[model samples]
Target: MVLRAWPLEGIGEIRPGDDLAAIIVDHLTEPLEAGDVVVVTSKVVSKAAGLATAGDRDSLIDAETDRVVARRGQTRIVRTHSGLTLAAAGIDASNLEAGSVIPLPRDPDGAARDLRGRLEDLAGVRLGVIVSDTAGRAWRIGQTDIAIGASGVAPYLSFAGVEDAYGNLLAVTSPAIADEIAGTAELVAGKLDGQPVVVVRGLPAAWLDSDEGAAALIRDDDGDLFGLGARDAVLAAVSRGELPRGFPVADEGDDLLALARAGTDLSLADVTVAADGSLEVRALSEDGAPEAHVEAGALAERLRILARALRREIVIAVVSD
Candidate 1:
């Protein structure tokens, strides 16, 4: 219940050959306890792991990525070598040379494990470790640090089947505690303040355990309901594109139009109504202009009201040219 954060400074001189855990321990006034979870930014880990290279930032981004999920001109969301979908493949240009970019550690979980082992040896206490990085969220503004790698800490706190105060069974109640802890720790590790390490104390003792790493926070691609489709995935494949697939597809008519509007661009003329009260839709411009011969169905009627209000009616004849 007691959460504490310690910001370690003067770490700019830390190089690839430097011992990061040793540096952090030297900066700490108090020894880390068995239950304390130390959150280290991935930037520092990458620096210590020699993940940086001299090359075109874009080229490095392309080299580190498995696929481009989404792109808006020069900006892209990519699935990186670490199996993480993030902006620019988590290639960082800040705090480094003009032509140099820092890629995330090849294995964040391994970084956390190694750090934990070193700390245990140096401090003589079994402790938890988390490697964190800043990431943006869908439909959210601002960025927060999340645990990309963890050791001796539970990634999530499950509350499934637990009853509420009213005795209602909780169906899904798992909380990404590791990520939450990382976010809390970031408040102390300022972005440009050279605070790469933070000591988190007063977390629940139960969270202290040696099990799987932060991999638990990652949802399986297939089992995820939010997993995007070929077209949608291609459109939004960048950065956590796998988690927004919730909510039923808009009911094949106006609802679909609404969803499209929220997720993509849509014009009123994209939909049409036929003489028989059926609804015909031309989802893509490649699908061609609305045809008069396409029949309108019951589902179309619900959407037609909105289409009509928007003057989306198409008057083209169904006859082939």
Candidate 2:
């Protein structure tokens, strides 16, 4: 129930192809126990793995980003190819040599597993390894270190189906223990500190046996309600851009109905849904204003956008006067 964590001091600078496992073993102020969890910053992992790249930071971010979740002014919160949603795709530019940036490890979970194996061999004890990274949260200020990768650790402690003392059944009470350990370690291995590693001891033995890794902590689209930002959703819907997997599919004719009920835009035209499920759009200009075709074309584009958002195939039959 009680955990003790401390940073490993006297660990010197890490560079490309450094033997991180050997460095950790050499600097152990105390011996690691079986239930101890080793938390490491991804910065060092990237460095040791030779992941440092000299390129435009923006280009690096773009290479790591799978899709953009939100954009406000100059900051973009993107979902990385590793399924992590964070600003700048978790690239580190600060606190490193200039003219180079480090993207997150190509495979963080794999990195954690490799580190865990190496540590166990070196330290002669069973252990859990967590690759940590600092990330900004949604609707929260500042940042906190979270476990982006883990090995030989239970990612979550699920209390679902467990009854409380008050006789209440817990339906959804799962804590991400890997992230907790990472955040706890971050408290001691601070940003200003040269420490990049921390040892957390006294965790429950049961929590240390799983090899599920940190990927279990990532929620799929079915469980993620806020996959896209509000403005991003609006822009995607209006521009016929592809929606993230989280958006729900609309019922039949929903797209057409929404377009027909649109105000102002429909004032210059008549939009009707026919029996064949095609949109029948007629330009209504009494004096045959040349703008009618323009309005009709704009409406057709809008119709396509709506259909795309609703996940439906729309056929528009336009009759211009």
Candidate 3:
């Protein structure tokens, strides 16, 4: 299947309460089709919704962040209230007047739905709308545009239960279609090009007319394997606070090499994998003194807590002198 995408030119600066649908319609160089998807940058949506504020950027980020996942000097990766894990809570500080920043639309899905309705009426054709936003991946460098809001577009395409070319059953091969479209559109909507809208055409007809929004792409903490960063996972396990997700029950032969890099003073000799998937841990000290035993017990308790958080079984023993 072939697809084509082009950014809408002549779109001027969007202001609060502007008719975004009309602006896009006016700037359309070609007619839209039923399967065409209109991708709008989240920054323009925020501006049209009057979400730009002249407040402290840090304060805005703090307010938008639900929890800090990781921090490196001045940068913080945080999860927002809307379940998006982003750097600086997806606040856009670029291309705006000094001291003014734009936060993502409070309800991107709803915004997309509303925009789709308006565009459909104006264009007289069925359409899909997506609100795109820049996001960084935990493991990958740099960023990409992803679908923060979507309407009339299938959020994901599941290939589960399908047979591959080699006749292998595909169990968990769902591709996030909305995000793919957003990223595809971003290729034409250059970052500094002032092009905030792109129209993607030639998607499968069935992919349109779907009600699933982009929110379906978000995996809650329980299901997300990387819910917490490596350092954050260790800190959460040590604090005995609400264990941030990510650590799952261990299976046999699961090499827990991550524990070795957890920034703890404990040696590899202290932790071992049992024959059955459970962990066997020796206390930190090997002295016969009562104080040493007490310290060992305390360390063992901490390991127990970490095990419980991970929902894995652990056998703890005190070291002998």
Candidate 4:
């Protein structure tokens, strides 16, 4: 099967309350085909919705984040209200004028659905719409576009109970086809090319749908193995004001220095306590239980509180590796 993806040019800069659908329609170099998928970049959607704010970046980031996943100096990963775990909650500072930042659409699925309706009416063809944004991966370098919002497209294709080419039954084999489409379409939508919309044609009929938005791509934290960054996992758990069973206590001299052997059988190395009382705790995954940091964080937080009571500075580092 052959597919074609081309970005709509000359759409110009989208302003607040601009007719996004009509703008794309007016810039169409060719007509949209039936079953064609319209890929819209989230930046333009934010601009149209006036979500591009000059507000304080830190406050804006905090307002959009649900929780911090990890942090090291200036970089941080966070989970947003949209159930998406991304860098800075997908609040980007690129492609906009300096001193301004753009955030993803508050309701991208709704935006895609609205755009799809307008496109169908103008072109008189059935189609799918995917609102996309660039995102980083957990264990991989660089970034790729993903479906942040979707309408009239199957956000994922599950292969459970199906056979592979080798005739083996598939179990946890669902592919996020919507993200794949968005990523593939991104090839033609260059970063500095001013191309925000791409028309992806030639996907299977079963891939198109009238429901199932991009939220389908998000896995619940309860079932996600890597939901929390190793350190943040510990920090969040420790913030609950509880310690792991059989861990150290502050009264027992288990201060910031006690984390080296904090876990009963867990051993941490390169334990450094900074002048300001910040800690750097590194643990190899092959060491004790992989999830020891969660408990370790709890242990560290308990000690940190004790230090604070004594008017001392304290911080702990639990390397996720």
Candidate 5:
């Protein structure tokens, strides 16, 4: 199907406590039509929501982070409360007056719903809405915009169980349409330009007028392959004092020591294994929170043979404090 993204121009600088719904409604070159998608940059939403803070950017990142996903010298990729894995936890310094950084929306799905309701009231037609932010990707060189919030739109178009032209059944195929719309709109909504709103047309009929929010796009740890940072995984594993399962021990050609330090999500923690395959596993607290303790015996059997207990103590010791 054909697609088009038209930038909404002439929007002035958005400010704290501004009426974003009214501002967007007033600045539209034309009224929004049914089935149209309203894509907005989170910068303006943050501005209108008064989300800018005088707090230090790093401090803000720490506050916004729910978990540390990955980190380098000065760059940290964290999962925010919004379930977005982003550098600096989706805290952005761009497009604001000096000395302020803006965190992502506290409730992006709610924000999208509010915007959608207001726009429909003003334009007298139903429409979809998406709030977007820029983020770097895993194993990708550059950054692109992704949908952080959505309303009245289907976030994904699943091809699961559908057959392709070659007639192969599709078991696992779903495109994140909300993110696609957000990225597509960014093509014309220049980051340096004042444009923050854009209207996209020609979306598939299935994705129109849906009330699904962007949170649906998040995959839980059960499905997320890169759930832990290499450093964090290593720290957790070492703290337990035994090699965790899935430690890449079977990859004979790989460097086991470096792999251990890089990080992993050890199933067990607070346990140490001896050379003779003996074990000293930590006891669980009163509530039995350390569910991993049960796996200690299984993990010991794997590590004791490989390290021979003597050579294992002196290793790269990577990961974080």
Candidate 6:
């Protein structure tokens, strides 16, 4: 696939009502092709969308965020107005007027669709458009540009039923093609540079006619197996301070086995099931110390992690002596 990205130089400060697509189109040396995908950073989109406002960065971040995911003193991972979980609600205080923070577009998907439609009408070519933004991964360092909005492109390529080179059936082989394209575009749209647009060509023919946008990238919450954990659920319940009418019993043995695997010195074989479905876990120290009572609630935390890792529900209870 041929991918090309260049800065739209000489274009000074993008104001609240700037026509970004026009600004980009007028600066391009070559015409956009039929199957080309145009990736634009959401920062510019947000600026044009009038989402930028003058305020303290933290205040703006707090206003835009719905919940905080992870916190480390001053750093925080928050779910933003766009339903995206990212750091600081994707707010940026740099590159704009002092005291002004650039927030993500109110509705990135709508912005992408509008831009794509307008570009197609103006350029007289069928093309895809993706609104890109940098986001951090769960277990990874550094950030990569991902598709927050998309038009005329399939967000993901599902290969679930396809066969590999070995002719083995692929069970879960979906690729987030939109995010991949966004990341590819970021290679040219450097963080420090003024480059805001990238053109990606030569994608597979099947993706050329797709109308699905980044909405396809959102995984169904119900379908997500590792959505919550025992600790998280219990903490949520504890915060409410009321037992749920019908909550699933988290499996404690599975958690114990996982913890043992994590060098906790316990195992499935070391656990026995009681009449009431509680689990009896036994552990012996290297020096042969007396067996200790491991709290079922405490053990539930370990099982919750295992359940999240396995992407399955587990039922567990601690055997009370």
lDDT for each candidate structure: 0.70, 0.82, 0.80, 0.77, 0.73, 0.70
lDDT of 4 at 212: 86
Residue-level lDDT tens digits of model 6 in 206-267: 88667677877766446645333334443333233332222122333234454433423343
The better candidate by lDDT, 2 or 6, is: 2
Q: Would you estimate the TM-scores of all the predictions?
A: 0.72, 0.79, 0.78, 0.77, 0.76, 0.71
For lDDT, candidate 4 versus 6, the one ahead is: 4
- For model 4, give the 10-residue run with minimal summed lDDT: 243-252
* Better by TM-score, candidate 4 or 2: 2
Q: Judging by lDDT against the true structure, name the best candidate.
A: 2
**Model 2 worst lDDT window (10 residues):** 245-254
Residue-level error in angstroms, candidate 4, position 299? 6.1
lDDT of 1 by residue, 20-132 (tens): 88898898888888788889989889988888789777767767777655444355666665667687788888888677889888889999999999988999888899999
Ordered list by TM-score, greatest first: 2, 3, 4, 5, 1, 6
Q: How high is the lDDT of residue 48 in model 2?
A: 96
- Number of clashes recorded per candidate: 8, 0, 0, 0, 8, 6
Candidate 3, run of 10 with poorest lDDT: 246-255
Across 1-321, the per-residue lDDT of candidate 4 in tens digits comes to: 798899998888889999888898899998889999999999998999999989887778777777666664467677787778788788888878889988788888888898889989988999999999999997899999999999999999888999989999999998899999999889988878899999999998988975989998888877788876665455334344332221111222334344323432344233556576577555535667645665556545555654554345556666555
Query: Which has the higher lDDT value, candidate number 3 or candidate number 4?
Result: 3
* Alpha-carbon deviation at 213 in model 3, angstroms: 0.5
In candidate 1, the residue pairs with backbone N, CA or C atoms under 3 Å apart (3 or more residues apart, or in different chains) clash, namely 69-237, 69-238, 70-238, 277-296, 278-296, 278-297, 279-296, 279-297
Candidate 3 wrongly placed segments (more than 4 Å): 243-321
Q: Please estimate how well model 5 matches the true structure, expressed as its whole-model Cα lDDT.
A: 0.73
